[model samples]
Target: MTKTLTIRRPDDWHLHLRDGDMLRAVLPHTSRDFARAIIMPNLVPPVVTGDDARAYRDRIMAALPADHDFTPLMTLYLTENTDPDDVAAAHADGLIAAVKLYPAGATTNSASGVTDFTRVAPVLERMAQIGLPLCTHGEVTDPEIDIFDREAVFIDRVLDPMRRNHPGLRVVMEHITTSNAVDYVKAHDTGLAATITTHHLVINRNHILAGGIRPHYYCLPVAKRETHRLALRAAATSGDPRFFLGTDSAPHTDANKLLPCGCAGCFTAPNTLPILAEVFEQENALDRLEGFTSLNGPAFYGLPANDATLTLVRETPEIPAQIDTPEGPVTVFDPGMPLNWTV
Candidate 1:
């Protein structure tokens, strides 16, 4: 077996580095491995304008360790009030990489997200003209729709029609979690792609509900059945350029996560590469790991792959159960098996 592997330093196409203390605590884990990350804009008060994005980028730079070479690719949270002119200017200045679409109440800190897609049509049109991709949460917030079915339903109701209306617009169905989503991406084949999360690839609904309720294993667009997890593995490891790594490594403190109505997210940044290496190795697709982790994300976002490389040694280092931050302790995702790779 191949014991050690080296590949171009990876980029996380989707990441949530919450500002202030949480940002300081978690940024190092991502920066240590990733060269760049598409920073999520769903802050407590979302990053909605060019000014907000620039300010957030500055804060990220300041927070980054002096020795690390990492870039924060900022994004704007699309809302009914989003300004097309500002988005264009940000992209033109290379301050932002994409616009994120979160259907109102869709996920964490998404109360300010878009409710009426039609209201944002002009903004989408402007993005299409300038070639800015729309990264979407890909789930509906309808109380009636079962949580497990939201992603598949969003494809039929919201995403498909939007693509049809603006054929030139590029869309990334972020952290998709179903076979239905996989089929949609394969069928579209152009100007559209999907990001598979590291946690989703490792866990399914069973991991969340089986034996007992595991809060650390829960995440939005919550993990589906075993069959869906298999599909995600196939898409991610298949060497298909449309699918790539986006470790939606959202972090919530243990206090919040253990509450009656806990937050949804898996804090996977600390152990993402090791877990991915184990998964790809198990699937006998180690050769394609670099493409999914390093190449595909940049290809979709129109950026160059990192010139630097990361080497993963075949050694099982003990992963900490949780990481400490000023806010509180945040639990690391338990992959439920021994990981034999470490970066």
Candidate 2:
């Protein structure tokens, strides 16, 4: 067995570092391994403009530890009223890396998301012209759609048509959770890709509901069946440039998560690297781990891979069950098995 593995430092293609105290506490976890991350824009008020994105980036920089060399790549939250000019200007100025599309009410703090796709057509057109990418929470929010079926339905009903309309637009189906998503991205030749989260690869729907309600495993575009989890594992380890790491390591205080109507997210930032190493090892695809976690994301985003490298030794370490923050305690995702790798 390969005992020690060294690869280019990875970048998290998608991440959520919430504001204020939460941000301060969680930022270090991600900075520890990832060289940079595409920061999510779905805060309470939401980051809908170049100015909002810039301010958020500044806050992230402020919260970052002085010794860390991590960069927070900003993104704008697309709204029905999003100005095409502002988006173009932000991308041109390098203030924002991409624009995030959250269908209104799709997930936490998504009330300000786009309710009318047509209203944002001009913005999408401008993005295509500028070669800016659109990162999406790819699920339809219709009340009638079975929660489990939303992702597949979104592809057939929303994503496919939108892609056909804007052939030049680059889109990332963020934190994709199903085989349908896997097949869809594979079938599309270019201008389309998907990010698979670390938590999704480890847990299936059963982990959330089988024995008892496990709030820590609950997240939007929730974990799918065992078969879907297997598919995601296969795609992520397949060495496909279109599939890459995006931890989507959202943090919610224990109070909020264990409530009657708990928030949706898994705080996986702290342990993602070790868990990933273990998963890749078990799949007997350790050779492809570098591409999946480190190389593929940068290749898809047209950015240079990190010059630095991270070394993971095959040594077991005990992972803490939870991390305490000023706001409250946040649970760490337990992969339900001991991890034998450490970075």
List of clashing residue pairs for candidate 2:
none
- TM-score, candidate number 2: 0.99
What local lDDT score does residue 324 receive in model 2, on the 0 to 100 scale? 91
Per-residue lDDT of 168 in model 1: 99
What's the lDDT for candidate 2? 0.93
Q: State how far residue 74 of model 2 sits from its true place (Å).
A: 0.4
lDDT of each: 0.95, 0.93
lDDT of 1 by residue, 151-185 (tens): 99999999999999999999999999999999999
Worst 10 residues of 1 by lDDT: 314-323
Candidate 1 lands at a TM-score of: 0.99
